[model samples]
Each structure stands twice: as structure tokens, then as C-alpha cells.
Target: MSLLHRIEHPRDALAWEGDMPTLGRYTAGIAGEKFFRAIQEHGQFLGTVCPICEIVYVPPRLYCEQCFEHLDEWIEISPIGWVHTFTLVHLDLDGNPLPEPLPLAFIQLDGADGGLVHFLDEIDPEQIFVGMPVEAVFKDPAERKGSILDIAYFRPV
Candidate 1:
């Protein structure tokens, strides 16, 4: 029998009905906190270098999957990269058409094995292409929060 079917008070399930209110909060934990802090405080981009396979992960990782070793080496990487791939989105998550199309891309930063996924700005969707060079644009230092959004967006270099 389902656990919910055996509840002592049927009112237990009703709390989930009809646009129930919710309180939600989250913490980014250690790895993420450090990564974003680098961006916010220093305007620097960072990555983790796997000592075993030598692959560098941007948005750094605490460990490596290939050799199962903990990654401890933090390296600074250039904010410049190429558009590895991209998509043009015309609709919002709710299926509503946006005022303008947004171009999003996976950018493989120079000197790193992994890449960052972010929105591409200052260009039309029809003009973006694979291998297009781009660079990060950061929010003003005073305006930054410790988050990936601290990068206002990536734009053609």
C-alpha cells in the first residue's frame, strides 16, 4: 500500500491542494560558494584541474571522475572562449513567447577542458555560430552577488 493512503489524518494530503503556499531555501555549499566568490570578489574565472587526467573543469569540482581522486588544484582560466554549441529560444519556460529571442551557448573556455553554459548577448540569433569567439561581461563589482549571474552575460569578443 502507498504510504500516503495510510495517513492517520486525510487533511495531511489536502495541504498539497489548490496552489498551496511553500517556503523554500537553499545553500550552494562549499564548491559552488568558492567558485562564485572568485567571480564576485576578483572578477576572475577559475577551474579545477584533475591531477590524474589533467582535465580542467570550470565551475570547479571537488573531485575527478576518471581516476576518482579529489581535485585540489585551482587554476585561473581566461574568460574568453568559443561557442561550442548554441540554441535560440523564442519562448519562456511557461511557453510564452519572449519579447525577443535569446541565444544560449555552451562556451569552451581557452586552456580548460570543460566549459560554461550561459546566455549570449549583443548579437542576433541568426548570426551566432559554432566557434564564435566570446568573452565574459561581469556586473559592476558593487552590484555582484556570489553567483554565476555575477557574469551579466557573454558577448562576442
Candidate 2:
């Protein structure tokens, strides 16, 4: 079946509004399980390094995307990273105006090629900027649940 459809006008596009039928659980896969597990168990960040390509994947991957080599070297990386990009969110989840803006950033972890996109806290949204240094703040050991929430948020270092 052809999935593409042509519409003469933007408003003529077909739409559907209702509860979605798609539902399932997301298992973090082999590499992701190791990555998040390290954070949950020890409050540490783990990355996989490719020896041939010499690329470091932050959320460690099972195979090197560049060379297709199996990745088995897991290394602990510093939670410290720099804000590669940032934004101030002034709208709530429902598109309503928020009382205070929320800051979010894509933090490039040191010694890794990729980064994590998460909420930024402990500083004014107006102060956020590119290349700003930040560090992950983890929740208490008892509160961790082997999830991304295990690390509460990233804050200015």
C-alpha cells in the first residue's frame, strides 16, 4: 500500500482524534540496560568505546555505528558535561502558559561523542546558554528505580 497522500491545501489533511491503540513496554536493550543500570546502581555514567573507530558512545551501544564492530568495553565517565544546546520552556504540557519557565538542555558528556537530553535545574532559564558546564544530580540510592529518573536532573557545575 502507498502510505503517501497528496493534499491540495494544508487544512485538507486528514486527522484523527481519540485515544491511541498502541501500547507497550520499552526494554532499554542490551547496551541501554548497562548504561542506565550503572546510573541506578552507582550514580555513574557508562560509555562504550570503539577501539577501531575510536568513537565513544555515551548511552553505550552494542555495536559501533561507524565500523559495525561489537562494543564490549564499558567505561565510567564523569557526569560533568557541557550544555551543547538549551532552551527555556514557557508552556506547560497542555500548551498553557506556565508560572515559571523550565530550562532544558542537551548536555554533551565529557569524553563521549553523544549526549543526553534532560531537564536543567538549579538556575534561572535566562542564565542558560550554549557550552555552559553542568553536572548530573542523582536521587538518593534508596529512591533509584533503574530508570532515567534515577538521576533527578542536570544542574550548573
TM-score of each: 0.83, 0.85
Off by over 4 Å in 2: 1-20
Give the per-residue lDDT of model 2 (tens digit) for 39-140: 988999999999999999998999998899999998989999999998888999899998888888899999999989999999878788899999999999
Question: How many steric overlaps are in each model, in order?
Answer: 0, 0
TM-score of 2: 0.85
lDDT of 1 at 67: 87
Among the numbered candidates, top TM-score falls to 2
How well does candidate 2 score on lDDT at residue 135? 99
lDDT of 1 at 92: 99
Per-residue lDDT tens digits for candidate 1, residues 1-157, read 6876686777866656476588888776566678899999999898889877979988788878788788889989999999999998899999999999889999999999888899999987889999999999999999999888999889999
Candidate 2 at residue 78, lDDT? 92
